[model samples]
Target: MIPRFNDHAANERTYLAWVRTAIAVMAFGFLVERFDLFITYASQNASRAAHKLHMHLRLTEWVGLLLIVFGALIILLASARFLRNRRDIAHERMEDYAGPVGEKLLAAILVLLGLFLVVYVGQELAALSSQPDM
Candidate 1:
């Protein structure tokens, strides 16, 4: 069996890496959402002729918020997985190697995540289509 310390260290490092990625994703999501919101507010206070432009800006802000929410969800799931995987690796028993339930679960989760992303993109596209042309 692999040594516990080595495996634990590796697992911790992997978890930390994932955490970093999650932070980046969340930060970028926030930036996108915030910038869009600023544009929306600015356009809203402008002249009446810019009403259509304001509508488009509002739509864009909504899209940005959706992206932020998606990213946040992804980060939450990824962090949970990383912690679970680290725990499994750190305390792995002989029986765990045989059935590998954790690995299987992780695989299942990844598949679900992919499906979620696909559905999310599709929904966003549908929403975009419902918007009036600007």
Candidate 2:
């Protein structure tokens, strides 16, 4: 039987969870980055004057790209953590995670993204409501 099989299994499970999260984040980023397509399609039928209106989500583009970058970073971080955790599990006493910086950074970025999206959406709604009907 493998020694400390439960600990090893738990470590593997945690690593897998991180991988899943990373994939999800990347996928969501791709979706957000593609918002440009929707905007273009929407503007296709708009009057020439409407075309001049500023309706683009420039910040959203940056956020989406950042998310994709973060997702890749997550994979790297998870792999490093998994390896370290595995090594620690082999010792008589496991040491604390050296710097937890990656996870903390990810959390902080996500929170900022969430807040930006909220404010962006709210502002867009207000602008839409204020505009005169076409």
Candidate 3:
């Protein structure tokens, strides 16, 4: 039997959880990016003047792309961490990983993203409220 099989299995399970999270993030990003298609379709029937008036930057696409990139980074970082932990376990020198640096960074990033999204939504609402009725 492999030495410390349970420890290795636990490490692998953690790695898989990270992988699942990464995939979820990427999928959400893709959904956000696809909103552009909906916007385009909605604008198709608009008059030229209306089209010109409604034209705006695709912020969602950029945010979605950033999310996808962040997810990919998470996957890479998680793999590296998993390997390091496995090595440590093999050598019987495992250290406590209570909130590792990478996880802390990810949490910080998520907090920032949440704040940015809140501010962005506020700005959009304010803009809509200030616009003159058509």
Candidate 4:
């Protein structure tokens, strides 16, 4: 067995966790992009076009695509980090390892995205409420 096998295992586990998270992000992006299609189908089935009080920005579709790209980037970075960390562990140079900078950045990005989503939904609701009932 290699020295510090447990440390290597831990690194592998972290890598797997990041991979799972990336998959989830990509899946969410796919769902967001598909929602427009879902809405269109629903409207068509209803036999009447849905009222649009405000112009549809179509931002969700772009945001979803960006999310998928970000997720892909995350996976790539995670694998690289995993290999680097594994090498460090093998060399017993763990002290040279930087902290979780990428993870922190990812968290901050997610938080900003969440805030944007909240604002967008609030504006949508406000617009809907101001419109006259059909």
Best by TM-score: 2
Please write out the lDDT profile of model 1 over residues 1-134, one tens digit for every residue: 55687777776786676567556655655665565555455444443345655565565566556656655665676678667767676667432443656447646755665465467546545655565555
Which pairs clash in model 1?
A: none
lDDT of 4 at 123: 66
Candidate 3 residues 22-88, lDDT tens each?
Answer: 9988887787666567545544544334444344336767877888999998899899989999999
Query: Residue 46 in model 2: shift from native, Å?
Result: 6.4
Using TM-score, rank the candidates from best to worst.
2, 4, 3, 1
Between 1 and 3, whose TM-score is larger? 3
Tens digit per residue, CA lDDT, model 2, 1-134: 98999999999999999999999998888887777676556445443345333445565677789889888988998999899888888884857657867678888989988898778667655655565566
* Residue lDDT tens for model 4, 1-103: 7788899899999999999999999998887666566445434434333444113336767878888998999999999999988888888873654777887
List TM-scores for all candidates, in order. 0.50, 0.80, 0.73, 0.79
Cα TM-score of candidate 2: 0.80
Pairs of residues clashing in candidate 2: none
**Selected candidate, larger lDDT, 1 vs 2:** 2
What pairs collide in candidate 4? none
Candidate 3 lands at a TM-score of 0.73
lDDT of candidate 2 vs native? Answer: 0.77
**For each candidate, what is the lDDT?**
0.59, 0.77, 0.76, 0.76
* Total residue pair clashes for candidate 3: 0
How displaced is residue 17 in candidate 3, in Å? 0.9
Residue 51 CA displacement from its true place in model 1, Å: 3.3
lDDT of 1: 0.59
